[model samples]
Target: MAAVGYTSGDPRKVNDTGDTLTGGLVLSGGGSNLTVGGSGAVTGDLSVAGRLSAAGVALPTTFPGRRAPFRDPTRIVTHFQTGHGWATSGGVDAPTTNLNDTTDFAKGTQAAKVVFTGNGNLDISGLSSIDLTGKAIRFQVKVDDASKLSQLNIRVGTSTTNNFQWQTLASTATSKLYRSGEWTTVTVGWADVHGGAGTFSLDANRVPSATTGFTFIRFQVVATGGNCTVHFQSVEVIDNVSATFPNGVVSLVFDDSWDSQYALARPKMDQYSYRGTNYQIVERVGQAGRLTLPQLRTLQDQSGWEIAGHAYTTAIHDSRLTAFTARQVDDELRNLRAWLVANGFHGDSYAYPGGQFESTTDGASIEQIVSRYFSSGRTVLSGYGASTNVLSEQYPPPRPYRILALSGISDASGGQGLVSSLVAAGGELDTCKRLGSWLILTFHVLTTGSTGGDDGVITQANFNTLIDAINSYGIPVKTVADVMRYYT
Candidate 1:
């Protein structure tokens, strides 16, 4: 029989040698697959780094990195490992540029680096038409210091004078929040570049038309306070893999099980025949200021809402999943999901308690544990203002466990009044309609009066107006689970 005490990462080996073992065995290692042959039977748990095939059938294994859905091959722009025909110009100080900086990069040995002191752009011009239809621009960017940077814009067009622009720092409000020294992977779809600091709209320019594909791509930086060094790596356009909704798709997700959500928001949503997703904190079901068990069931059974899982513990804490051992995370997720299933609630979807999926706290393993219990995990807004996650998740989400949502709708940047919210929602809806992407709008508490205060609290009137506006757009409003099913 094979060794019984072997565990994952253990430097132990087991060779069958045509032996028919009767006892259970444990097989695990770094990128090693264990096979059972010659009437060998393993009745215990098996841990594997790669696939485990028995009888020519691949056994179910948790390959954390392979959870992403298959995607079409990506089109390359430049890897910056070799000579690239890019140049720089137009600045007060004439910013320095290098196409092959060996020191900083996301892939290969080198990357295109720029040292900016004023307004300038790094661009490659006079190129053959490269079709960008149904494609998105993705790259890894690292700013030495984002505080000194005023703005950074990504432009694509025939030239600098006529193109669609998207001010990365301005549009996402990352200028004030993303003050770090890490490489951030940014993905921008065609719809993302429609407005926001652009000279013209994508439809008016006929830029990505079949006759005239895009000819140039530029990275413009404005730095006035001080000099900032930025690195760009693995810049390319990839086939847009997100599902397209003809009229767009919206998922109204309410965080926490606040009583106000069941009492006030439910009624408003019910009036329009709308349903929502409630990411309930399992431990707070019957707590004060929270929804009771009966109310939650009503939302799911009678109102047709989805009661998803969130905050596995009784008290919601930051980094709850990441601040523990892998075994602990597994237990927490397993128990929470078990409670939901036993209580007759559909618990396939989840949301991070405080957007705690960070490398600093071993959040990757937490995600693996989360994926074990949930079909999808909705992340907090902008990685809770501390991460590099995007504002909205694309359909067929690159990472189902890291699904991004649009939140903080009451913030200054998002605009306050009902009119402002409506306008902002309309703009988001426009992008969805154009791209057939998904938008998950998250809210926390519902109040009867006042529209300004916390990002989590939205007045009932504004909430009603938001729902009415969504209905007016003629888009399909669905719960999170429903959207995931439709896309997957």
Candidate 2:
């Protein structure tokens, strides 16, 4: 029943007394080969807990044609369980550290409650100086009433005055990540933060050196003429911020089949010898302000673009997967794919209408239904709002039926868009190149102005600027289908 003895000759030579190892056998302790005799059979079950190896070489957990688990390189900065030399400034009260705050905590039974007395920061320091190059700062925040707070910022530096900060409320992409009465995880990447007056130097010395290290990281909160309370947890530095693609791959996906995108953006795309994916709502084709059927054909037959599926209803909002009933959801997906195939488009890939759809809800029925008709389904948000380093699809996404994408592109203004600035977009490209991930940039409308001026609109000049940057990066700009084919 139980035979656990090892001989020296064969590394882990198990001396079995019974014909069958009843419970199970675990081969451990410096073994190069798991030699079940040449013609022997694995009668019952053999479980390798750590890893399986052969001929003194370890075998890969991930093989070709399958996605690999993310290499998580996470360094914990704090969990607010202990008084780790934390302090407050600018009239802010000191953190009320709680070791058993079950009612107000994000992770463990520990959380830090901070009341914003005025306009100031709650900071922690005395770190061992770790290099934060190509890393991101992630944390969870739960506010008593988020609407009461006018602004929130995550800052890092060698000192209070010498730091780089990202205003979460300054951008639309990041602003959505904040919601009161619930915990929100915020991720700020290395390239997203900017220096202020008398702060750290630019680029060369922006990130604290291994010697100098980071002195303190603070959450700066601004109230709308009153005080507010917030809880913090799980502050971490993530090194493997994104999954690696073979190389940086960019996919320009224009949703809704906007006539402006086809007319204004297509030519610019052609100028750069690039193609895009057009997620057309079936009912919108030939409708005023939308791409006509012929225009969609030209994009496919002439421009080398992928005309993918989007919606089937007369209006997109009516077809939103999140708002649909089970019957409606089934009808929408089935009808939408049928229309795409009938209209001579790639009906294989799908873009959820309004960037709506869930893979985990409803027993993953929506995802399963989508998978029935489409090879891949794309969504607008991947949950890491505005952090370019973490904004990309894994080479072979864990969920092919529900692929993740970054939405919105606009001129650097209120930081309302995903790629609000040239630097942000460049950061995304750099991340893709460094991590070998896929950067799928979503667009809606194209205009001719310095600023995008409205939601979902990127000015013509800015669109051109994006194209120039993509070209400069030397990354292959492929259509969604093409990228899927190459990777899959």
Candidate 3:
């Protein structure tokens, strides 16, 4: 008495959510069109293991979407692998990681620091809290069995003038974590910092003379030398919504700044090169912000990374996405996409800078048009995208969601894992759709000290742990562009 396959709906298609294939899963070859829609049903073992994808008549390199082929990259913005020895890959912004170097922090060779740079005043306007404690951005630093660290905490805001005049909403860094020396991970929770705590606050406020504000944050380490290595695993910033990996497959994309580098860590962004090229600091936004070539690499090397376009500030209004002009928005999208193609990127994902809440109220047609070009997108509704987000249900059109955190937003508070997401998703993994998936994470460096940055800029060590979690969950972490190709 084996279970029969679903007999309705087109499982492979991305319509307005409710339309779906109901039965008969298959593993046979060339069975894409074998969809048992609203009127068909399968009572046997349905298997479609070999089938030529949309690009061919025969099974191609792999089953369509089975392996989710990687997009060709135009460059490398930032990359690291604990298994690969934590060597720096593309572009350089902060201190570089060299697994080959005897100073490998993971191996306890030398000490490392997580630096954050930005335009002083952060915005942390709508979050619940900002405390970092057991919940800290973790990074794996391998010790050489002899490296010693006197300070396990952080030194933020030392790169700017405002220092640390921001408020502490809610944080866990009230104390610091000492490196145990065995793949030692340190946590600089929000409790460890305070308002006007400049010097090492990494809060980049506008200098007194600059119209914009201060412009940099450097996470430096107070270290005692030894000889080993530190393999950077991942950088996890929380509370962000983004279009990633498969959604907007591309050969090239541009990030527009080097501030994120400092946010990830001074060493984490060192000598960064992507697809085998180094990114240059293109420009600084006075106190407004800074743009870099490597930062641009995030757009270029999107084969693995996801890039989202944000409204040029001022896009969110009463939850009815509004801004300079539709033409302006269109221009931004076109420019961003063109840049990707120009650089050799093939991805087409879009992570709205503002969130799902920005769904245009009077411009439904305009939003729809944008949707046509991009595939399967989500505007944070009421679910945890990391685990609870899925492909089946229709999201609320008017945007019935709110973001407690975003990857790059500054947090004068505490956050970690899926706390906010879980709360938003209402703690239901069952609501997560397995097919028409959409994920988005947003970030803003200039807002951290005042407002709050998306918690996504996580510690390399914590990032790796998160990677393990995502992989363990069996949900493929895709670039937004790649996801769109299949959905569209």
TM-score of each: 0.68, 0.58, 0.31
The number of the candidate with the highest TM-score is: 1
Q: 357-475 in candidate 2: lDDT tens per residue?
A: 64322533566666666777787764333343334554444446546676767764553354534334346665465434567888988887667754688888888878887787677
lDDT of each: 0.65, 0.64, 0.30
The per-residue C-alpha lDDT of model 2 at residue 8 equals 29
- Tens-place lDDT per residue, model 1, 1-488, is 53544455664455454323355544332314444443433345544543345675343222222234434435788776777788887662443566688877878899888888788788988777777666666666778887777767788777777776655662233213233476766666654553422344544321223313778888888886677777877677766634346665788888888999999899999988799999878778899999999999999999999887887686434445656765556556666776777788874688877665533244345666677777887776442211222235555565676676776555324332223543353355555655545778888888887663456787787787777877777778888777767543
**TM-score-sorted candidate list, best first:** 1, 2, 3
Clashing pairs in 2: 171-415, 172-416, 244-435, 244-436, 245-436, 245-437
Question: Which ranges of candidate 3 are over 4 A from the true structure?
Answer: 1-258, 261-291, 311-321, 356-364, 376-464, 472-474, 486-488
* Candidate 2 segments exceeding 4 Å error: 1-71, 82-100, 170-175, 196-199, 203-212, 225-227, 240-250, 259-275, 286-310, 316-442, 445-466, 475-488
